[model samples]
Target: MSRSAPASQGSVVLQTLAAGKLGVWPLVFTVLAAAAPLTVVGSGATTGWAVTAVTGIPVAYIAVAIALGLFAVGFVAMARRISHAGAFYTYVTRGLGRPFGVATAFMAVLAYNAMQIGLVGGFGYITAGFLDGHGITVPWWLIAGAGVVLVAVFGVSRIDLNGKVLATLLIAETVVALVLAIAQVTHPAGGTLTYTTLQPAGLLGDEAGTALAIAITGFVGIEGTAVFAEETKDPSRTVARATFIALAMICGLYAFCTWAISVATGPDQVVARATAEGPELTFNLAAPYVGAFIVTIGRLLLITSLFAAMLSFHNTAARYFYSLGREGILARWLGTTAPKSKAPRGGSLTQTGLAVIAVGCYAWFGWDPLTQMFFWLTVLGGFGVLLLMALTSTAVVAYFARLRTGDASGVTSSILTGVLAAVALGWISVQTVFDFNRLLGLAPDDPVARILPALYLAAAVAGLLWAGYLAARRPHVYRVIGDGAAAAIAPLTAVPHPAVPR
Candidate 1:
């Protein structure tokens, strides 16, 4: 394949990514690692109080899970056909066109970068607090900077190294959470098991939007299976299998833990207790049902969980850059990979640079590490993710509907699943935008909440216009936009020209 273009030619260069370094389980661990299972349980237990306080946080988790399952149907179908690191953006390009594809790619980079950088704040704060409890005090930035260095190192190493680290942490934390949750449900804190927690009324009315929004964010990295396709053993089967397994694990774990918490506190009182105690709600209940020692382990695991998420998002953001660079949408150097390690070294360093700047900005302005840095940025990232998923869902429908005449199969290429996922994600996108203030715990007119969503709009416009310019002036490059490096070369050879000299 043609991997590069000479600088004298004034054409974009592209490169193929490393391949076949991951298996199904490793990929599953990688994607689930990004979700930060323990962190979700701890935070959701508190954030969910708004909805479960009234009545369906457990149900909300299940509902969101169902929507994601439908999304997986069409998404996996596309993955089978197009095995690339670009994920949703690639699918959008093939199904829609190059311009829309580039637009999505730009949005993805912004969103994933926001999500990855935002996580460092939470990790640092939690690490600082955990250390403070041990009679050691350090500023959160110090801990965050230390993490950046560690993650930067890991990001440039082989991906399986990350898979091993994440799996170990994931298994430890998941076990602790499950043990406590089982104990809570098996014994019942108040000696009564109430079924009211499962009713739809619990998920309806005023705060349902907020509860659902939080639940959806727990699944943010679930789509990452598509992101690592280039490295997986069997791009099609492995990606799909790993995606399904990860989604099942995420949905089952999240719902069980949330329901178990309600069981421990009794559905009626869980909201008040969770709101008052925050993450302590789970530990306090676990101390009696399990043991103080186990609760301590769970708390410790919470810190590791954030680190796992940081690593996962770091890799994810790096791959987006690598893929975009390969498509000529970014600087060619961004696509370079380490030969021996098969790591996206250039992309990894870029992501690390971005993280440093974000942390520095937060430190310089003296923002609240937990609220401003963690909560605000993560929510913005989640909002961007929802928008992207909704667009991909539409793209899937459009991509397959075109094939309905004869070539496409009934089950694999049907537009039904895509429609279902698109509608579901589209509704959530709207809910998130309209209820942006509630999600951020801000008033309706808060500048931060109101202004952040507009950034996505700006990114989309800029990306589309940039793509339009390429389409008009550099049609050869435009033709190869999301088709990968080898595919890109096909266009350069086939570019049409005038039949005769003017």
Candidate 2:
């Protein structure tokens, strides 16, 4: 059996990912780490109220979660059938077509890299602030550079080991958040508990679009569950279960924590307090009840929370590189894994290099790490992911409708769900776009407000062009666009290509 023979002809040996290395809980922890519950409650959730001036942040979280839950139904259904590291990319490719898949591949890589790299800015800002408060001085970029190195080390290590580290940090941060929430809820403002923020009506207010867009950022990492499908012990069950579990945990944690803050500060005053105190508002309110010691711990855990998110997103971005390389959409070298640990070393190192460049540029420009680097980049990344989700939902319906393989009713229900999710997510994506300026805290006239969203269009167009080039000049590679490991086994042929999709 020639190693280069087509998969239809015979067996072949090629670089492959480590399989069966993760379980449901490990996956749950990893995805949860990406959400960074502590950071979300302390920073993202608080910032929503402060920046958007929307008092309905708690319900906005619930609204986004419900929309995502609907998105996941089609998402996991597609995941069960296609187990690959390139979750969205593969789904879109198979469901849509080769060119669209390649386009999605590029977008996924860009979005996840933006997400992972953006965290270093956040970690740097928060850690520097924490250290400064303790009479220790350190440059934010220097600290962020150190964090990038740490994530690089773990990115090339065993996947399960990364999961364990994330689990420890996630558990600690979650406990702190829960304690603070309970403390706040028990000692409500004016000695009365209020449910004004939790009312569904809040989601329909004037600034609700901005609030929902901001809330969606908290759930950015949940879709990552499917990215680890190939490494899970049972991709079908593990990916689905981990996704739902992580979603449920994140939704509940975010809604409860934000609502608790509202209850503690008085619903009418929560936004004002958040605007004045910023991220410190959460701890400031809880300190009186939970004590300065617990408050201090929460602050420290906030730093770790950002670090955990960095690690999780790094691994995800690396795997996207690995998948593209394996499928011949990018440099094949990126597909190579470590011989011993089976880690995606090539892809991991690539992500690390990009991180170093991003961090260095921010440091050199002397920009505000928190606002300029973290906020702008992360929100842009979230917007990109939102676009991918909408596309993937449509792909799901297209893929399942074309297959028609399952029970009639089951298939119909799945298709219907996909259509509904597509409609919901599509509307949300539009809302997010319209609210992008508010989401980034930028003025509507700011040039960045347009440039950042334009990046996605640029990526998608570049991907489509490159896919067209492959179809014209490298037909063999073009034939196996989203085949994953099977791409390696596919026979090399020089067959003439049909017209590539526009």
Candidate 3:
């Protein structure tokens, strides 16, 4: 499809997004909603405790938090200067170049799309299981189809409405988890809530890499804080503050809840029990300590957590489409915002349509949504995100190193943290690649595991080529690549118009 000409020639008036609507709390809840606290507490915690061994699981969460925190130092620094819905993609473009920026944008699209679609599988599987426990019979795909409808509706509505819905669900799930954790701590299974699990020796233990990787996945949506910068009030501070707040919340919650589980189960038995019971491990602890009713409530909340995650991710994916569309990088029609709600309705519809097709395919093939689709695809998404983080880290260094006399905060904020974060994230990205098979629950030499990295590589290469084509043919469109997209398109007059369309 051909892109619309830029705004210079008075082509289509570039549509501006809704603005000054989101605040710190709403942004925090929206980003955290994507993390899905219940899923992290119940499923993710159990997996880390069991698959990676219990001793280091809690410590792993903290380490991942630190790594991400370091990454955020530079991330927020860049956000203050460039206020765009394109978070990592924009950072990479501004720091690296148009080609790398475009490539990372495609990578972000792939990663977030995979993540959103993957969460749908988990929602369907978990919801189906939750209903089955209550003696209600429903197909997983049917439930998933219904979710697509709801998410699409929310995706197109006002952003605050989505925030309220997400906040309610996030609070419900957090309350349940915190209650269970508090009970377990107050009435320790072994007569003490020990700090033994938080020790560094535990992190250096066997299968530590696997534990770290899973913990990183739990923080999957952390980087998305900047994605809503365009819509947030005083985004310069709001986005940065929300990023740290979300990070602290995830780190503290995951560490405490996992430790509480360990203490409640008796650290000695935690790993074995978790390995055997999986998600039910959390419920088992809650059954005796928090009551069976709360256990059921927690289960129900888990369903909502997954649903909240789906909705959060649906909004994120829609905005990525919106960013791409407005920049004339993708189909121009996808850039349109609803006149009343100012929502990226076109992108929202496109994402919803993709979800439907994905759910349909999973059902047609009779694949296990939990294992094949959710677990596998989410890991793949995590891999892509890690790759982008590493690239963005490098971009942070490049962007700052070249700046001689901007806000000194940019240089001070980025230089040290930029270098440290680049090394740390780069290491994790490499580790993720080597351990990809383990992440996918496949044999080390599994063909699918080996092939998955190629998908990301191919997308990046294709994106680079496309950026080149834009430079050679669609120069005006390429000039704004990774530049302040929302700013460029926000003003009706400054909107760029190229004489030729690609």
Candidate 4:
């Protein structure tokens, strides 16, 4: 296979990333580190109050984590076969085709963008809210705008360095937060865990579905291992193990914490109480168990956690763009790597610029981050992920169908699992879009909610169009799309295209 035009001696950058910069443990820690605590204060928990709500906070955590693990059963297996920079897009592209692969890449880019942008919006809110309590109120966009700059700096830096910093921050924040949560639950000043909350009489009737929905939000970044495939030393073995480890850590931590908190609040009043208090219920409850100082630390950690998440996804989002561009789908610029650092400079810059632009627009319009930006972006982002998973699973089945006929290995089982995963994910995509009423206003004004998925569709269409154009003009790049060919899997380099074309 022809490499994307031959390498230029001076213009082309060489690979700086070794096969195994990150071991299994570090990789798992990096991905799950950002998502674990985010469940507590994200839009899901905040607005869950508006829905069915949960006061016995621990119960909510327990339920949400386990449900997310269900996705892992199929996701990890796919991870084993499709280890590349494009992650799901690569899997489907090889299993499916270049055109559909481009579509998946677009979906991933949008999904990751929605997630990162939400963090930016909400991080500002948390900071401003904390300040407001101190009798000082500033605008939310200003804080968000600042965060975009910080994220860009980190996003363009070395991935290993980012991993190290994340490990330190995550370890400190989760450990302290967990200690506080455990203490509060075990020896609550308020109440004790009992059958009331566990079997909460009307749980299934009312809060069951609602709790499950909110819980899914906590596991948002579990697929993050996909993003690190290029940086991973042994992607097949490392990523496979990392995915399960991430799953276990996230689920185990959240479930136990939730169960503990349920004990503290006493299950009977959990739903009503969590609902009344809104997003503040967990933090408020912690003040007594952990002390005011600990609560303050938690608030600061929340800000950092959000920033960490934003940074993490920003990197992942850039790779989606990078993969698409390398395949000649989007612009060719995103395909370029930076020399010396060997990062996806073009893609990272694009993501950062877009995010900054979004922050600017929200600021210009004087829009509220909590109400407009956070709510819409996060929910829609979730929808994009569902679509990507569904489509990628389909691609897996397509890729493996031929092999299954002659062989009796797990190939057949893999295809079957992919088929089921695709179906489930597709249903979720439809439900999420149709159920905008839960997040948006009760009436026609809810159009904004529907727009997120619409944006995803538009982006996917654009990507497909680009892929078609590439197919017409550059057949070589187009053919490499889903085949997992050697040329398409170029090493991360920083060199510019040679002025002399092949």
RMSD in order of candidates? 6.9, 5.0, 6.7, 7.1
Candidate number that wins on TM-score, 1 or 2: 2
The per-residue C-alpha lDDT of model 3 at residue 122 equals 78
Q: List the residue pairs that clash in candidate 3.
A: 6-496, 6-497, 7-496, 7-497, 8-496, 8-497
TM-score of 4: 0.81
Model 3: how far residue 234 lies from native, Å: 3.4
State which candidate has the highest TM-score: 2
What's the distance in Å from true for residue 455, model 4? 2.5
Superposed model 2: Cα runs more than 4 Å off:
1-21, 83-85, 157-164, 405-409, 492-502
Model 1 lDDT tens row, 1-502: 6544533243333122223368899888878888988888876446446423434667777888888888888887776655443567777887777788888988989899988888898888778877887899999999999999999988898444466777888999899989978887886757988767667775566666656677777889989888767677667688889998998998999899888888888887887887677666777777876877898899899988888888888988998898777767788799899888899988999999999998898888998777667766776787788888889988888777765665665445348999999998888777777767777777778887778888898889988998988878877667677766554564555642211011
Top of the candidates by lDDT: 2
The better-scoring model by TM-score among 2 and 4 is 2
Which 10 successive residues of model 4 have the least lDDT summed? 493-502
Q: How close to the true structure is residue 143 of candidate 4, measured as C-alpha lDDT?
A: 79
Q: Write the per-residue lDDT of candidate 3 for residues 1-502, one digit (tens) a residue.
A: 6566753243344333334377899889978988988898887677555544546677878998998898998888777765453668778887788889889988888888888888888788878878887899999999988988888888888444467777887888888999988887776776977777778786565455666777787898978887667677666788889999999998999989988888888878887888788777788776776777888889988888887778877887888888888888888888999998999988999999999999999999999787677766776787788889989989888878777465575687687898999898787777767767766667878898788877899989989999999889987678777654543553354444221122
* Predictions in order: lDDT: 0.78, 0.83, 0.79, 0.64
Per-residue accuracy of model 2 over 288-401 as CA lDDT, tens digit each: 888889899999999888887888788888888988888778998999999888899989999999999999999888887777777767777787888899999999899788
TM-score of each: 0.87, 0.90, 0.87, 0.81
